[model samples]
Target: MKKIAYLLSVMFLFSAFAPAAMAKGVKKEKTELTAEQLVRVGEIESRVAEIKSMDFSEMSKAEKNSVKTELKEMNKEARALNNGVYLSVGAIIVILLIVILLT
Candidate 1:
């Protein structure tokens, strides 16, 4: 029937838009680290170990705090970058469609 067809179209449109709308609202927690960041962290840890071996008291509190802050920001940026690189919206939609079909 015409009404049934119209209803189906409306439902289809709603389903298509709903996921995107929800995805936009949902914030992915940024936590993924990049290779560069991993390297930097390793370097920092190595430096810290070297400093400790030489003299743990040599590093001022301010210097240690600055390193910690830099590492934390690097980690956060790495996470945001990861979300951009992986989990693309199109991929998510395709996966969603596949799952829906499977169900």
Candidate 2:
């Protein structure tokens, strides 16, 4: 049992460290918004609000479809402009556990 456990731990450690040793450093993406980007984001928000306020019931099928496509494109652009790190519940819990264990 002792020999088996020892071998397993050694295998785990080797597998873990090997990836870190072989992997190249990755370039991080830009997270902060510039002045122009901030202004664009504001414009996107106002446009979305304006679209929401309009009467969709009166529009034709083709007009509604066009509006839908435009909104999707604007949403994608807004998300791209608002680039930032987002940690999930599981990630936060794991980080907390790691911190507690280390301390």
Candidate 3:
């Protein structure tokens, strides 16, 4: 049936990329990045979105490399920021509890 075919194709697509996605996720979480890296990520994300919106099958190797680099750097920055937020929130809660106890 057509439905079965569609499902098979979807499964194939997912299976093909699942391992790569998992690896990327791990790599992203392990890196420490700077603000410039974050900005590069935003730029790369936007470029990727644009590329997806279009029907271009051919992209320059340099362009692809640039985007990949930006995304990787951005992921690193995000992980750092996420940890920073957790620390700040924990500190704030501790301070609030101390103030409440004193008052």
Candidate 4:
């Protein structure tokens, strides 16, 4: 009887604490982009799409190289603009894992 009671109490305590621990592990926030950033991202995406739609076979060597460089630069810019959210989500996942492990 005593063992059963102790086991039940322990289970109850775990159930109560588990949710609080998980809650602490997560934080939600809204991300908003400024009008200018939105416009710039849209423009970059459209330009990349335009580049992709071009006929590379008809282009000369120099034109191909220029297109490649331009695409690389635009990709870098897009990554820079979006990396913050990705990094933060990665951090949050790491933190949650740590919390779960510790608990």
Query: Which candidate has the highest TM-score of all?
Result: 2
Q: Candidate 1: deviation at residue 94, Å?
A: 31
Error of 2 at 6 (Å): 22
> Candidate 3's residue-wise lDDT over 1-103, tens digit each?
8677656656765675688788875643555667887786677678657755754357777777776786677667656555642447876775565455444
Query: What is candidate 1's CA lDDT for residue 60?
Result: 88
TM match of model 3 to true structure = 0.31
Encode model 4's per-residue lDDT on 7-91: one tens digit a residue: 6656766785698798986876646777998999999989988998999999999999999999999888887777553447876
Q: Please give the range of 10 consecutive residues that has the lowest summed lDDT in model 4.
A: 94-103
Sliding window of 10 residues with minimal summed lDDT for model 3: 94-103
Name the runs in model 3 displaced over 4 angstroms: 1-56, 84-103
- Give the number of the best model, judged by lDDT: 4
In model 1, state the lDDT of residue 48. Answer: 57
Count clashing residue pairs per candidate: 0, 0, 0, 0
Clashing pairs in 4: none
* Model 4, position 44: C-alpha lDDT score: 96
**Model 4 collision count:** 0
